[model samples]
Target: MKYSSILFAAALVFLAAGAAAAKVPAGLDRIEHIVVIYLENRSFDNLYALFPGADGPSARTRWAPQQDRTGKVYDLLPPVPDQRFPAALINAPFLIDQYVPQDAKTPDLVHRFYQNQLQINGGRNDRFAAWSDAGGLVMGFYDGRTTKLWAYAKKYTLADHFFQGAFGGSFLNHFWLVCACTPKYDDAPEAIRAKLDDQGQLISDGAITPDGFAVNTIQSRFQPHAASVTDEARLLPPVDLPTIGDSLSDKGISWAWYSGGWDDALAGKPAPSFQFHHQPFAYFSRYGDGSDERRLHLKDEAELYAAIAANRLPAVSFYKPLGIENQHPGYANITNGDNRAADLIDKIMQSRSWKSTLVIVTYDENGGFWDHVPPPKGDRWGPGTRVPALFISPFARKGYVDHTPYDTTSILKLIELRFKLKPLGSRDARAKAPLGALMLESK
Candidate 1:
């Protein structure tokens, strides 16, 4: 071979060696089961604000003062509508437990896509209190160290810099959790399309964007949704994107989405808090109502327990708790939800799969709550505010605090890495898997 040809071959060898050296963290292949325990609506600051050795807030933390819609800075926070807070309060993050006990519920905040973007305020993260319908409550957080899950976190790995995938509420974030991409509503009616002000902030929240993206909550086209059968226009059109479930099934890997209240929802007697929009797979055409895949993969929360007890858990499982135990504000209290999550973890620890399983506990979104750290910019969709994400496994680094920048799709990336599956989109394609939190070469 010529000198140039030899040099080309040498360079190719060098590149290939580098790629091989960057393999998935050691011992990852041993994780046969990954359970993603997806809870609802809480920011990192809202839940883990007082966690030791984590990037939590303190009394001396500087806060960005909130500005009203007209760009006027607030001298005092607007009074909370519930009259639970003191009449006058400074414009900064406060301990919610000081007013409402950790066991109590608070009013829901506005967590729409456009509003979330506006609240982020170009990453300043100062508009939450201003844009929130619950007013000053947006800046409130609990002393999370008192929660039952805190003990689990102390025993495992806590990811302080993790973010939710999408820039909105549970609906879009749920879709991102499965697909790492936004759902489309290409021919949505104008009435439901969001109306934005000149500054690109939402004048009124809508289910679809002006450009035909479903960034907000909309009833699924499938059965068990709130929309009437005749109200086709009101329902979100069936999405065509491939989800993590699809990818796993294509590879003959077992997986299931076990949701609380799913069976009841199908029986047309859904709990009052059974949010139809939270079911991401129900909107996909492949999982259409009565589809065999739907029957096989979409299961009830009780099935998760049975599977755990029987050691019959799938390779990958996504578990969504019922609203009452999901830690969502407005209906769910933090204490009950935290206790439920701890109990679930306890049950899983006692299961046969415990030795080989990886359990990821995280929230769906910030739920319109405020956080100190701004999300790293990604695409037009999100990586919204910071949400609590933790790693629990025998292989997980004991009592470690992982500051690696990760989003909700990082969980999907972890699964993809373990299963050797291709990423569904650019978002998860670039997401850093959470393998760094695990012990390498344990075998």
Candidate 2:
């Protein structure tokens, strides 16, 4: 009895010590600005497969053979429908630049909610080519070392294990970035709900689920948006849920969602390349047109640069480039977007706030690309396919590749921890913060 009592006390002491050691590192508090550059779809493997020191594919690695819907493994991958790629490619990851150079645009792959789940194939990650609209193009990747972003990665910290917070595409993942929860369309029409087979495989694609979750790309009902009043039945209603923007506002901290071509979109003269669904917060009631939140928080990309130049950037900033410069497949080529990103980083570095600022560059989702690393098992929404993320700050470890597993919600976690704000939802509350990259040393 005496020995047992002593052992219990020692265990308690050990746990207490661990708790103390887990406290937020002091250096994180020094960051005055948190800038999130949310780029368009590109998976870790899509852009960073050849990156040194990353868990990237190598010549010796064996890729999982793709299986068709009936479960037959393909000996040769299906031909890329547009004939942009070779017709007789084998069933494995290939260096895309060898055939279709990075400067040329490629056909966009199917990246909808149901299709993504189907392609993941219960985490085997072997059905991407079978389910992809772009066929074997899904298995293609670039030699990232040749890209401009790779140069910045070599000088900063690259997070090799980070994933998108949600499955599917930009619209849903953008919401996850702010709220860490799926948006709801509670009274959605039956016609819009996804039709699933008995095996839970998608028979037809949909913007909303049977139970009312908005999983696929859907237009917002607000003005300056793509949807009109006549399209109300299909559009997403004003979301009433709290977002990271709301939390920041409550504390009187400055923040903004800066998107390219915002001013033109509002004037009904939007650029041909402007995307409506990319503006996630515009769907919220608090940020309706003419509302103070809308006027003050939603601005043009030019404003972001002006703020940076003037050294009065907001405490939190989200910059979404125009579709033409966003690096999305089909619409934009990789080289143009790569140059734009490098330019943004150079401008940010010129700011006086650069010393105390942390810039996180990440993609919305994998864009239906094939990645060898299976995402960690998460909830129905996700911590989806691995996406390349980087930390560019003076405090970031120079030339380091951080392998800590994180998702889109990790951005929220970092914001909440630095400002002592409450988490917007369960996902962010439980998410592991990106302190491994932000902190000065191992915690």
Candidate 3:
């Protein structure tokens, strides 16, 4: 057997053993709702370097040292000025604590699919700077002491080993979050297909280039409207993949994907900040425009707040904030996203459903940020770079750290097991369910 196939088979065995060993918590059925608040960009180390008891980068802990293009380690990283706001950078990875003030945004880094693979560099993890557009900034870390979300982590369950499911950017990872599989464009046009070299690295401008890693970000030929043609590559064609949403519906379990600025974006409003690619359900056939499933399952963020207030949240809910509040570098700052998330958590806690709710706060992908730990060996797609995942519930072990390894598909696994739904038959089937000591009480 091929090496990768052997590894995959071994992984499946491990997952099966893990599932068999973990008994479903007795009171899991009492947890009637699962709320997934998905933020954007930032990696675990980028935002939680100081999170207590978590495996994070530090002078003593594993350090994410920067490397130049030539693979030489940089004693001190050079300044990476934002393309839009070149003057904002402070020349190095400065401590972004409460004392530093938090109005400005950092420049965005390249988090495309191929670039991530290059950064991972077969688990060497020393090529972040050599493969990045943001130079040494790829090795940056933040002080968790400044953030409200960090406080939430300290007060709740932080899964130190949680990772983004796929190996790419927000678009594909969002699909992984719901579907646990890569979106496919059968017989895609040559223009859209990534050009790869002998070693499988992306080829661009007649040469293999690390900077030309656009594996799946091409514009879709099918646009929502005429004006949407401006960036067709960004929109993926509608897919027919079955999602966790479909599974929930099959079991008659209530669910919704609440996204910020959904209505305006569908209306063809320019830069609506709705982020079309971020809406994974919108690209699925069942939830296509004008479909009844779309109307019932997809909603606006405002509706989420209303639902919380009215205590009418569904059994499964996924919330995506607007661009400015998403904590994505280049446009949004971490402070804004952290504060908004903290407030949202506060509101959720205030709701009557808090006692029965298990809220998961996580990110879509690493967003080109540096993390010291290498991702686990899974399939060709991933268990990508480590991202922060917080389990917030009345039953969650308070002030505890969960070291159990989990990918984005793990969320789907938990939901599937809890609702007695069939597996999606991809990573979700083999992924470890969030079981064991994560909960404080059984019954």
Give lDDT tens digits, candidate 1, residues 255-346: 99998999999998899888888789999999999999899999999999899889898999998888898989899999888887888888
lDDT of 2 at 355: 83
Candidate 3 worst ten-residue window by lDDT: 205-214
User: Tens-digit lDDT track for model 2 on 1-443?
Assistant: 00113322443354344322124557777888999998888989999988889988787766578989889999899889877688988998899888888888989988977778778887888999888988898989998777778988899899999999988998999999887767879799887888767666567778987667888988888877763436678888999877899989999999999999999999988898898989989989999978999999999999999999999899999999999899999898899888888888899898899988999999999998998888888777888888999999987878989999999999998998887777666667678998888655432
- The worst-scoring run of ten residues by lDDT in candidate 1 lies at 1-10
Would you list the clashing residue pairs of candidate 2?
none
The 0-to-1 C-alpha lDDT of every candidate, in the order given, reads 0.84, 0.85, 0.74
lDDT of 3 by residue, 95-208 (tens): 543223455777789897777877887776777766777766676677767678887788888888999998868877887889776655544445555665666546742111
How do all models score by TM-score?
A: 0.92, 0.93, 0.87
lDDT sort, best first: 2, 1, 3
lDDT of 3 at 13: 63
Instruction: In model 2, state the lDDT of residue 97.
Output: 89
- In terms of TM-score, how similar is model 3 to the real structure? 0.87
What residue pairs are clashing in model 1?
none
- Candidate 2 is scored at a TM of 0.93
